[model samples]
Target chain A: MTSLTSLASSRTPADLLRTSATAVWIFLVVATVTSWALGTDHAFVDNTTAASVVVLLLAFVKVRFVGLYFMELKDAPLPLRALIEAWCLIVCALTVGFFLAG
Target chain B: MTSDVIDAPASPATAPGKKRRIPGEEGTWIFIFGDMCVFAVFFCVYLSARMADPAGFAHDQAELNQNFGAINTVLLLVSSLLVVLATRAVHSPALKRHAPRLLAGAWLCGAGFLGIKALEYAEKVHHGITPQTSDFFMYYFVLTGLHAFHLVLGLAMLTVLIRFASKPEMSRGQFIFFEGGACFWHMVDLLWLVLFPLIFLVR
Candidate 1:
């Protein structure tokens, strides 16, 4: 496995773009656009509940990506990583449940 | 880990041995997590209020400019990407020269976010909107306002980071401090990631 330190040592612009951090950035940007499309007034879908749920879930997922990749939590100690993961899951679940409950 | 251990070229944290390590100081993580918990409570409060008046909240949410929220999201994400790259550069001798520039770019992105947020707030006020407008606008202003305060702090942290990155050589303690600052900036981005959808998008 390529270590994060090694990935960060990437020299050129192409090498930089090919790094895992850049890959995660691309994923996050696409996810943001997806959430925007689904939840905005211009949304094609008619189901507000479904759209809201997806948007909320996507937001949390993006949060996790920022924590894991951008913040280097993926390379962190297991206990710390698990704690953050649990936080993400629990908060997301509660948000979804509350949204659906109403 | 002590500074000596961290300063070692073959430090377990960065070596190929794959020893697990926290990105920043343990105290920093504790503070980060604590701050997150507080925001989580804020989120729950907002949701509970929204549930009480879903129709009103949804109606007001529609009035928000999703474009501003989306653009701010992009700006923060890009800023975070720069910070991530800058953090990486800090760890590599060959790339170290670029760290200051990368951090500056991140700082610029943060400034862009603040600029857009100011415009958003002005526009809202121009249309006779304020925190006292309604429950929804109240939460919107309060939540985003608190978030903007954190962003300002993060920008200050980035300024310190740029100064540190400009140094020819950084002590391991300074490096750890840099990592901690970078993590804090990412936390700002993380909060906004949820705030955008919650306040602007979610019905």
Candidate 2:
């Protein structure tokens, strides 16, 4: 929560929203593109585990950005924010671990 | 910069140094949290199912078009972004008038998602793939179908919020409702973000 105030205060609510949303949007787009490339590229196809981990990890991070900004959890009550953070960490870790292990 | 400043006058709850407060009713978060827990269990069920027959699951997964999932991920993210803009716009007197349009755009993105999903669904059905087709198809349809149901609800909620938010005179109560709805919509998007990779991309 305390870590995110700097970037959010630069503009009016709308401008700040637009700025943060745009930043997240661009980051998501880049992550998706990278995932697509890694998913479809011939060389990467041979390494399914590596490709899967990379793409899934990218998705995990994108989820964090969405939760923090769009969900308005950055400034949420500490317990709520902590809950979300923990959920993300657990879900991502469990899913990736299961994917690789199974 | 430090936790001390946050506790100085604002207390830990307000974190005065942190200028913004979490929007919407705290009660709504309980629902959001509950929904997250329900979905987590669903994901676990999926993992268990996949582990039983990894080969079949992987084969059926390849049948899904990654391009579609990739496209929809961006679409949902953009929608959530627009909702964020609309929610925050209500906070600024100068930008209040623009909230409705931004929200409408967000709603349209939700519509776009359903449209793409329908097409994907139709293609699968045309190939004789259905929930009855196999275990993977069952999970695919059931999981995504449930998610689609949530997306529709999210859209309707957005529309309601837009109606009140766009008005020349909105109550503080209305603004809070709008914020809550926007958060719900983003939760829908967040669920999909996790679902997309788990169901479509991960090998």
CAPRI-style docking class of model 2 based on DockQ: acceptable
* Alpha-carbon runs more than 4 Å astray in model 2: A1-18, A42-45, B1-16
Per-model interface RMSD values are 2.2, 4.4
Which stretches in model 1 have alpha-carbon errors above 4 Å? A7-10, B1-14
Checking candidate 1 for backbone clashes, the offending pairs are none
Tens digits of lDDT, candidate 2, A1-102:
223333323345535443556677888888877877776654346887888898888877887888886786877778878888988898888888777778
Error of 2 at A71 (Å): 1.4
DockQ of each: 0.65, 0.46
Per-residue lDDT of candidate 2, residues B21-81 (tens digit): 6667888888988898899888878988898999999889889998888799889888887
Q: What is the TM-score of chain B alone in each candidate?
A: 0.94, 0.90
Q: Where is model 2 chain B poorest over a 10-residue stretch in terms of lDDT?
A: B3-12
- The per-residue C-alpha lDDT of model 1 at residue A15 equals 46
Q: RMSD for each model, in Å, please?
A: 2.5, 6.0
- Every candidate's TM-score, chain A alone: 0.85, 0.76
Q: For model 2, what is the error of residue B122's alpha carbon versus the real structure, in angstroms, after optimal superposition?
A: 0.7
Tens-place lDDT per residue, model 1, A1-102, is: 244546445565344445577888999999999999988767789997899899999999898988998888988989999978998999999888888887
Candidate 1 CAPRI grade: medium
